[model samples]
Structures are given as structure tokens and as C-alpha cells.
Target: MKTGKLVIGIFSIVLSVIIGFQSMIAGLGNTLSENGEAGGSGGFILGILMLVAGIVSIVQRSHRGNAPVIMFVIGGLLGLILAGSYSDLYIWSTVSLVFGAIILIFNIRNKKIAQQ
Candidate 1:
């Protein structure tokens, strides 16, 4: 398995879990207000999208397909946009970017290997 894909997949999955648990934690702590509910929902949705994209990227990389590498970049750009949109959640965005960049680098490396 490509280390790049595995790392991204794990990070995204972990982030997704964290985003999901944040809501649960807030609810358990009785800290969620009406406004907070909607506010957090965005993270939750984005987390899931990232999670799915990450998984697909990994699967594609394992198959040696180039299409999934593009997905990584798109996911990363989206994460960057999301990070800028919400200062409090830039960590996820950063992780997404790293994941995408790593995958892209690995893809380039693999292509070079194939050419050589």
C-alpha cells in the first residue's frame, strides 16, 4: 500500500471521528446551544466528505490509478477553503492539505518510477 494514501486515509478517518465526537461531547456536556448545533453541523458534514474522499483516494492509489490523485487535490483545496472560512477548525484543513500533497508527491514519484 502507498504510504501516502494510508496516511491521508488515517488522518481523514481520525478527523472524521473527532468531528463526530465533538458533537457528542458537547451534547454530553450539555454545552450545545441552538446556534452551536448548526455551527458544528458544517464540520460534521465536511468531515464525512473528507473521510469518503480520503478512502476513495487510497483505493485508487492502491490500484495505481491517476484519477484519485486529482481527487486528493480537490479535497485539499476544499479543506483549505474551509479552513479559511472557519479559523477554529484549520487543523482539519491543514491535515487535508498535507494528505493531498503527500499523495500528489507519491503519484509523481510513482510516475517517474514507471518512466524509468
Candidate 2:
């Protein structure tokens, strides 16, 4: 069970990194619209947040914390708010949100088992 959680955590971290890079690359091309200036900036920030979340998730030995949850959630929200005209940004952000939820669920389950 612990190994499973670690695997998921690692997967989530890798996914976040992939999504972050994707968002940033797309962000570069997103600088041609009316809101272009704000587009890349938000994606960049979102990417950074996602990366931070990934880092946090990997650093924590116990999967029962809320730091990863919060960071990923914030990253997801930022992606949604910042994804004005970029369609890809929406997908990336949504994925980040899902990963956050996955982490949350895992954490909760871990806590429950610990209690037992």
C-alpha cells in the first residue's frame, strides 16, 4: 500500500512536470492575441507552481500532508484563471486539478489506514 502511494506520487510529479513544460511551450506561441501579454505569464507561473508541487510531493516521505494538495490546487486554479484564449491551457490546468484531487484522496486513505 505504501509502495502504491509512492508510485502514484511519483507519477503525479512526473505528470505535473510534463504538463508544466507543455503549458510553457504553448505559452510561447500564445503571445499573438489581444491578451497575449498576460497569457504566457500566467502559464509560466502555473508551470512554476506545478513544478513546486511536484517537488514538494517528492520531498515528503509521508503522503499524508496538505502542502502538495494546496500547491497543485493553486496551480490548477491559476491555470484556469489564466487560460484566457489558450485552449490547451485549460486541459493542462484540468489535469493538474485532477492530480491534486488524486493526491488528496491518497492522503486521506493513508491517514485512514494509519489510524487503523
Candidate 3:
């Protein structure tokens, strides 16, 4: 469980970095476009949320409760919603969502093991 959390956390961080760079490139282009700035801003926000989720996952490696799980789920959903129009952003957002789902599964399995 700990290893799973660690791996996912690392993956999330790496994904965030990729998303950040991609978003900046996509967002900063054609400043004259009406939606360009909005998209870029959304992408940046998504990147920040991903970063926070990664840190939280790394710092809280225990299966103590649902806090971390909730955070992951929320972050993932928000990432999707705020992924902007970069198209590529959806890929990262989806990855983040998968990471969150994996963590949730880990938490559920851990709980079952504990109860047993």
C-alpha cells in the first residue's frame, strides 16, 4: 500500500510538470485569441491542483482515513473540469483521474485487509 501510494504520488508530480509546460506553451500562444488566456489560466490552475494532490498523497502514505482519497478524487475531477481547450490537457487530466481511482482502490483494499 505504501509503495502504491509512493508510486502514484511520484507519477502525479511528474504528470503535473508535463501538464504545466504543455499548458504554458498552449496558453501563452496567440494572446489575441479570446479564449486563449482563459484556457491558459485554467491549465495553470489544473497544474497547481495536481501538484497539491501529489504532495498530499506523498505526505499521507497511511490508510488512516478517507481524507487523502477525497483529496485525490476532488483534485482529479477539478483537473478534468478545468483542463481548458488544449486537448492535450485532457490526457493529463485523465491520467490524474486514473491515479486517483487507483488510490481509492488501494484504500478500499487496505480497509478490507484491516477488517480481516
Candidate 2 displacement at residue 71 in angstroms:
0.4
Please state the error at residue 105 of candidate 3 in Å: 0.4
Candidate 1: which stretches are off by over 4 Å? 23-39, 64-86
Candidate 3, 34-73: lDDT as tens digits:
5633555566666777778778888877854555566556
C-alpha lDDT of residue 1 in model 3: 91
- Which regions in candidate 3 have their CA more than 4 angstroms from the true location? none
Per-model TM values vs. the true structure: 0.65, 0.77, 0.82
Model 3 residue 98 distance off true place after TM-score fit, in angstroms: 0.6
Off by over 4 Å in 2: 8-37
Model 1: weakest 10-residue lDDT segment is 30-39
Error of 2 at 97 (Å): 0.7
Model 2 lDDT per residue over 7-116, tens place: 65576667656666766666676654444545566666767777677677766647577787787788789878987776777877887788788778888888889899
- Cα displacement (angstroms), candidate 1, residue 48, comes to 1.5
On TM-score, the leading prediction is 3
For candidate 3, report its TM-score.
0.82
lDDT score at residue 93, model 2, on the 0-100 scale: 81
